[model samples]
Target: MEGTRRTTLVLLLLACLLFLSLLATANSQLRTDFYKDTCPNVESLVRSAVANKFQQTFATASGTLRLFFHDCFVRGCDASVLLFSPSGKAEKDHPDDLSLAGDAFDTVIKAKAAVDSDPNCRNKVSCADILALATRDVVALSGGPSYAVELGRRDGRISTIAGVQHSLPHPDFSLDKLNTMFTSHGLTQTDMVALSGAHTIGFSHCKAFSKRIYNFSPENPIDPTLDRSYAFQLRTMCPINVDPNIAVGMDPTSPRTFDNAYFKNLRQSKGLFISDQILFNDARSRATVDLFASNNAAFNEAFVAAITKLGRVGVKTGNEGEIRRNCAAIN
Candidate 1:
């Protein structure tokens, strides 16, 4: 009888250990209320900071959104994109990120400051979490659906220009290239289409899309796929010798609002970037684009889902990274 009791006790101990292991794994992942106890006001503080910036300029919405995208694509959503290396070799210093607006970085800095204002929250919130919340706020403030952002992501310490160039999908990426890039991050083609909807609220520099408007090829001076009138407007806005710094809205119609119009523009061959228009050009993604163009609700739902998945990419947690004292520099 004593021998039987010893065996039963060992079994019970093993079961308890297994349960604790599972619990730890689950807790290590992101959660909706990770900061509820540590920084209860994190969400409100981020929202107010983003709102103040948005009130200053509507461009803040697109800027912050773009910042989040760049941050995630390079090294996950670790806020490494905000880091400033002494050698000027950080992710944001990459050629592709040169176009990332200053307003976006400023918005994050402001949001971080606001969060740290609370004594209980000072340096307690991770820049990564602040960025996620700011991104959600930007979308909601710009007439898009607001989704709950999962928290508990720690800040990454590494940011390299080479990583940005290798990881980010460029404006000139083909549909296949875009798919491959997104797929590497565990995002599906449908998610790529939905996330592309973010183009509805942003602007592009002439240098980024001028080839589409003029001298696309030796045989076809202009891209034949581009709409005639739309091409003409782009040509005017981005003349062959025009200053590269000049910018044009990605969505000419209601560019300030975040909506499904980007997909609609893709259907009409009015997409501003080759990457944006290629969704409709490819057979695999075209149907998804059409569906989103026709249904705003569906597009918004997919976008929320995709962005949430994006926030989970390469997350740092459970002693994996630090909560930096300053977002732009590592402690």
Candidate 2:
């Protein structure tokens, strides 16, 4: 009889342990109030919308979608960014910055891909969810941190072109200017430099900075620190008379690989944009850039950490935002 009692006690304990395990798993999968119950396939919808808008533009649908998420989450994941105009201005004549069209589209697509890849994602994640997710993925892909992303954001009903122009920082801004712009968006100088690592993979047109390259104006000329050989190459593409959109990606070695090459190049003044050069010049950001450039393990870890934080900034939680049925059209 004592043996029988002992066996029963063991069985009871095992049952209790199993129940606790299951409960923990259930909690891990619980959907927060911020996220709307949605499906994973919405990424496809956003990709289609973006590709349809810019089929063969300088930017890829994938890259644009990534930018959209980054911008929205830097403060709050607000679709106000998608509402900009041609000159990077928001809510004006163009109603949407066509320059941002490619990047914006790409951001949404990648964000969805990241969330779908996560096994923990069970609820129908919306486009807004994708936006935050993509920001985390791209930054990590660029050798930055990968931080946690809070879900549950709603899309904006209205979009304006001027809004894009007004919001996006100028490509030629000094490190100080960039700090102001990023800080205004609730990001730090470290984030500005780290996130700007996006430039490592993407490219801009010659027309975008032709005024600085050819014009004798020092105030707007390309940063003096750029490699002379590289500068000459850029000039060849953007001649004085005919300035066209040319691809000058940040990573000259392997534009596709998201690594610390950007920081390595910056040390040599190979950074393509003035903003890119400024990061290395500043005391606060220089060390971080160098650390990432030298230590691959450290860079990867820090990149993930910063990106995760970037994804969750200014997010709308607990019923503040909605889940869009279709990411392209306003609901």
lDDT of each: 0.90, 0.57
Tell me the tens digit of each residue's lDDT in model 1 across 204-258: 8898888887889999877888898999988888888888789899998889999
For candidate 2, give the lDDT of residue 264. Answer: 84
Off by over 4 Å in 1: 1-28
Residue 301 error, candidate 2, Å? 2.7
- Each prediction's TM-score against the native? 0.91, 0.67
Model 2 lDDT per residue over 62-170, tens place: 3653455445533345554443334533432342234444555555654454455545453356665666555444444444454555545555555454334545566
Global fold similarity of model 1 (TM-score) = 0.91
User: What ranges in model 2 sit over 4 Å off?
Assistant: 1-62, 73-75, 80-96, 101-124, 135-148, 216-223
